[model samples]
Target: MTPGGRASTAAPAEATATTITFFGGKGGVGKTTMAAASAIGLADAGWRTLVVSTDPAHSLGDAFGTELTDRPRELSENLWAAEPDAEAAVRRRVAQVTEDARSTLPREVMPAVQRHLAHAAATPGMAESALADLLMDAMERVPGEWDLLVVDSAPTGHLLRLINLPELLGPWVEGLVRQRERVASADSLVAGMVGSQERDSADDDPLLARLRERRGKLERAAERLRAEACVRLVLLPRRMVLAETERAADQLSEAGFRLGPVVLNQIPERPDPRVVEAVWRRFEPQGVLELPLAAEEPVGIERLRPLAR
Candidate 1:
């Protein structure tokens, strides 16, 4: 424990290879505060850290006492921050996919394709999928630029769904690709038997290639999320919060995600050690961290540095 409250040791020097950390929990559990503080901590310790918020109702900027755009902006010497506009990203994806279809598919097939894209934009998991796409893209663009990535995710349910996206959508996209392949093969066979016009090159089949590409992206995202990231749950020291953490832990474990340390945030000045221990034991995290409730709201680098420690 440090001066203000319990603290974790600085991340080992060897752990500086573009790691991703996710901080998530129920709403109002100080998720943004803990994530921002942790990012600042990592940055202060000499890592190039980029912290981004995936929550639609963004508050990361408020936590930092600064406005953030979709592009990351410097928050300090080593820390940068951004709040991705998920809806905007989804809209862009929809337009891009539709445009690709329009350019490649037959004219008569475009109206139906447009309708399908419209429907997909409203699909249950589309937003989460789009968010995941943004995350993966960020990772790809950060090879030598960033050493640490931290995400202050949406509330537990939504964030978990985002993490599970590849598992949920990968097979669906694969099925679509498989079905398209079967249709294309049958069409070729028919054209051959009837001695019709020669079929175009396989590389010219845009829809099939697009489907395969989507599947590949989803699979890669899912594998990276499971294999290369650390997930931490932030919570208050309330029974309801404890119960929620247990449920979230089970869900994450079942989805093949390993839970890292749990941050017990906003502890009272004279917090009861027994109560904290009891609640922490329920989650059985690798470690438990305690953060004192701030006398004033934590905003800006100065106020946040101590909490980060």
Candidate 2:
């Protein structure tokens, strides 16, 4: 709605490449299912699309019935999909960083820092940063190449972190990368543990420079994407799911994020009077996954084809 930005829809509108939407919410809310269908639909309607799953437990591969990897794999003709490996990505990031540090830092301090990263990677927020790096890479290398970049996100904690994280941590990571370079040069601006001239002169500065530059690029990826990104949430009709949605909306608002459409997945489909009592009976227990209800399955392009129209 800004000069050339995407407009929010009160109802579904024509699809355009400028819009990048995310399907997210509670674990069992059919996010991956909906996301896959939507991407397939967009592709069928003539837009080139990519669907990336940020979840540690990825299922986009299963949803598409095709083998996938960190790299984009073609599904049919126009749809491309990937499931970013959060843990493996973290290890790759560390490998690149430590390899650069091996020649820069004093032999004693470098090993200690490497060990610290090993333990830190086992924690929660560490993996998210690595995923953020992937997000940055995607946006820069292929901007304007795809009509849509849809994400099949993880559960609440990860979904919240995925979009808002880069902006919050970008400066801190940049500062740390800068500090490492300064120490390696023996300037020891903050950590005066070495002689001024004896700093690790053999260290690589470009690697740290690239990391810092990458962080800056990531800091803007979300907002830049937001010019078209809509954080659409899917939810069950149950009280717990709806209540959780409210809390998520509030928290994301605090981080400058807004929720788009709330997809009511697993709702009942056309019913007959003969099965009236039976339908409610089935849904009452299953809550959202009953057979009589509209089972949110991937329909390839038949269902999603209209989303772009």
Runs of candidate 1 with Cα error greater than 4 angstroms are 1-18, 186-202, 270-274, 283-285
| CA lDDT of every candidate | 0.78, 0.65
RMSD of candidate 1 to the truth, in angstroms, is 5.3
Q: Lowest-lDDT window of 10 residues in candidate 2?
A: 283-292
Q: What is the lDDT of residue 186 in candidate 1?
A: 79
- What TM-score does candidate 2 get on C-alpha atoms? 0.73
Q: Per-residue lDDT for 1-309 in model 2, tens only?
A: 111123445324543435666777888777887888778766676666788887778888877666789988887766889987778889998887787777556688986988987888887767877877776666554435665678887455654565665766777776777676655555544334543444342244656666677666766776665565666666665666666866775666565554565565665554343433432343343232222234355444454443323
TM, every model: 0.85, 0.73
The prediction achieving the highest lDDT against the true structure is 1
- Each prediction's total of clashing residue pairs, residues at least 3 apart in sequence or on different chains, is 0, 2
Candidate 2 residues lying further than 4 Å off, grouped into runs, are: 1-18, 154-156, 174-204, 269-292, 295-309
Looking at model 2, residue 305 earns an lDDT score of 47
lDDT, model 1, position 178: 80
